[model samples]
Target: MRSLFGDLRGKIVGKNIKIVFPEGIDERVVRAAARLKFEGLVEPIILGEPAAVRNLLSSFGFADPGITIINPEDYPEYEEMKQKFVELRKGKATLEDADRLLHDVNYFGVMLVQLGLADGMVSGAIHSTAETVRPALQIIKTKPGISRTSGVFLMSRENTHERYIFADCAINIDPSAKELAEIAVNTAETARIFEFDPKVAMLSFSTMGSASAPQVEKVQEATKLAKEMAPDLALDGEMQFDAAFDEITAKIKAPFSPVSGQANIFIFPDLQSGNIGYKIAQRLGMFDAIGPVLQGLNKPVNDLSRGCSADDVYKLAIITAAQAVQE
Candidate 1:
């Protein structure tokens, strides 16, 4: 990820992106924010007490390079933000509800991004996936024409330029065929943002009807729907993993598909499969798995693994900023 992050920093240097880190009090976030500020990657907006944040940076032998730190209780525009939150939630939340929810760092940081004070956000080092994602869905919402959001991992290996995307890994527990189709289209767009010419393979247990089951039928129905949704997309599936990744198996199992043997974006049938697949590749194949990046949001907001390192926070912040520039 070191070289990849360097290239991304260079790519987005002049874009003037600002990324919010809501977990400012976490040790990991403190170190990552220091590196981002010192290196001038992007202006990082931190949420915490100003004095404590500055002290933490000082303890790390660094000075604040003017990173924005906002305390929810002390923000001058608290009333304005409260109204915005209430309006965004329509009748679902009252003014009082908005006021209390805004005090939660994740909600406050997401509001910063939604209001254009920050271009993007990266959180979840010390929060659950739902806590990081709920505000995004409720406030930022999905992009127009997208009914759902999904998570994807950009898988790459050391000393190898082969980069593949694995999707639906961190969201959509048991997506229907319609939701699966949306994940495919949204993930393909994310692949394009990262410079992958997407050839998507929607995976199932059966490859081209070599066997039959409800699970296979779900993938098959989704492949048809996705083709209609993005006709130009190089996508085909209801296939097995081997047919998606191995040229030899693709020839025998799904020979007619233009993307069967050459897929770079893989959409799993469910969260259980997608999550386990990416971990397997990361641990066994030694691939660098760089996401769980949220797709289909109106603005970018990514979640980190709970056990993430300072380096993970640093890289995800850059990736979130890159997504900002792409928009």
Candidate 2:
């Protein structure tokens, strides 16, 4: 198996991906943008106050020729686009609030993608995840095959070069059965993006008929619904983690399962489990987990935790750009 970074390199090694940065310019963002530009990875578009953007760069004593600057103030489509987003909200948001929001770096970044001004967006260094995604849902909305938007984490072992995907980690708190199925399907699609033939495992605390709970039933029901939704996909569920990955345990627990011991896409029951599970794997197993990756939107719009590092933004920018190609 290829490393995740290897896969990213293959897909984006020479691609001229466009990225929207709403903060105009920050040192970290500029550095990553410059690196990507030099590597022939992406064409970065920074949106904000041009003077402030240049001042920030000069203050750092760095000059980057790779960045293209756009002033949000002078953007002719600002008011028109803001109203379009507000109208998309359908009374959920006021025009005043929407206009005020466009000034936000993340908001402007996503709107650029919405209007086809850019290929994709990467933001969230100064905003919450909800603050980042809400604008995307209100403006870009879901795609044709998508019923909902969710998140996924792509985890990889550097030594073994093995990779796996987990979904619903950053969104959908306690998804219903149908929603869980949606998460599975969406995650499988993400797995496909990285060239994986997905074998989905809907994880739970139980294995087959060994245990029963409304929660476990929810996972089982989700598996059923996902099968209905994607009948041709190789997927199964309501299995414990062991059964999903351990050949011996899976044989005993899920004798008839096609995904037993071979599942690479793990769909969690809820956000809490998915979030904590990926973190534990990252810290203890030393796996590189890339995401809380946004999926199912009409365009490639992603959120960043305020705690994210510059490297996170760079890699996620690649993911967002990949999403743009898919769209």
Candidate 3:
């Protein structure tokens, strides 16, 4: 984990990437922001009342923390931000509506990213996933080719140093074949960003055509779409977990498939499997899961688990900045 962060830090150092923390008053967020700024990893723009944030910093033993703090009520550029929000909404919101929404820390922090005042934003330590993602979808929105965003975890084992990408675990309850394709392709890009050469496997209960069912067919179709979308990507599908991961099992099950025995990116059939799979890896396999990192956004905006600690915030902020550097 330390080596992983060291690599990420090397990528963003001296890049002057700016990241926003909406829950600036949260102890975890503040501590992480302070560490980020102190290390020169990224410029952290924290949203909160100046006095309150300053007091928190002091309590955290950061008497002279120089991090930027923005209070929505007293921000001088509120009008400008509101105008831009209205323009971005394109009549979905009025000035009055913008005024109400932009006062919330999440909305205000997202506006900073949308307006290019900040490179990215990270929240959800104290906010729900919806509260953090809603503003981003409304303001920053998805990239051109992507219809919706997806989340992925970069699962790494400390002892073995084995890493893999697990996708759509944080969003999309029941995606269609097209959505699953999008998730797979986007997850592949994320794998590359994290220094993995992606060999993607579209997971299913059945291996190849060993079984026939609606769920198996969905995985098959998604594999086809993903291949068409990224012809260069090394992707194969409709394989069981063992077939994807074990060399002997893969040789018996899917010997001819490109990703059969060496797949580093796994696209689950649905959110349930994706969520459960990563947790099983984290708990039983003892792999350290590093995200739910939201991908396919116009700019980076990530959500943290409510139970995340200061160190988790610190690492996620580094990952977010690394994404911005890639952008």
Best by TM-score: 3
Any residue pairs clashing in model 2, and if so which? Answer: none
| Comparison by lDDT, 1 against 2, better one | 1
Model 2's alpha-carbon lDDT is 0.81
Least well predicted 10-residue stretch by lDDT in candidate 3: 188-197
Instruction: Candidate 1: give the clashing pairs.
Output: none
| All candidates: TM-score | 0.97, 0.91, 0.98
- CA lDDT of 224 in candidate 1? 98
State each model's C-alpha RMSD to the native. Answer: 1.3, 2.3, 0.9
Q: Which window of 10 residues has the lowest lDDT sum in candidate 1?
A: 1-10
Best by lDDT: 3
Per residue, candidate 2 scores C-alpha lDDT tens digits across 208-236 of: 76798899999989999999999999999
* lDDT to native, each model: 0.90, 0.81, 0.92
Candidate 2, residue 189: lDDT: 83
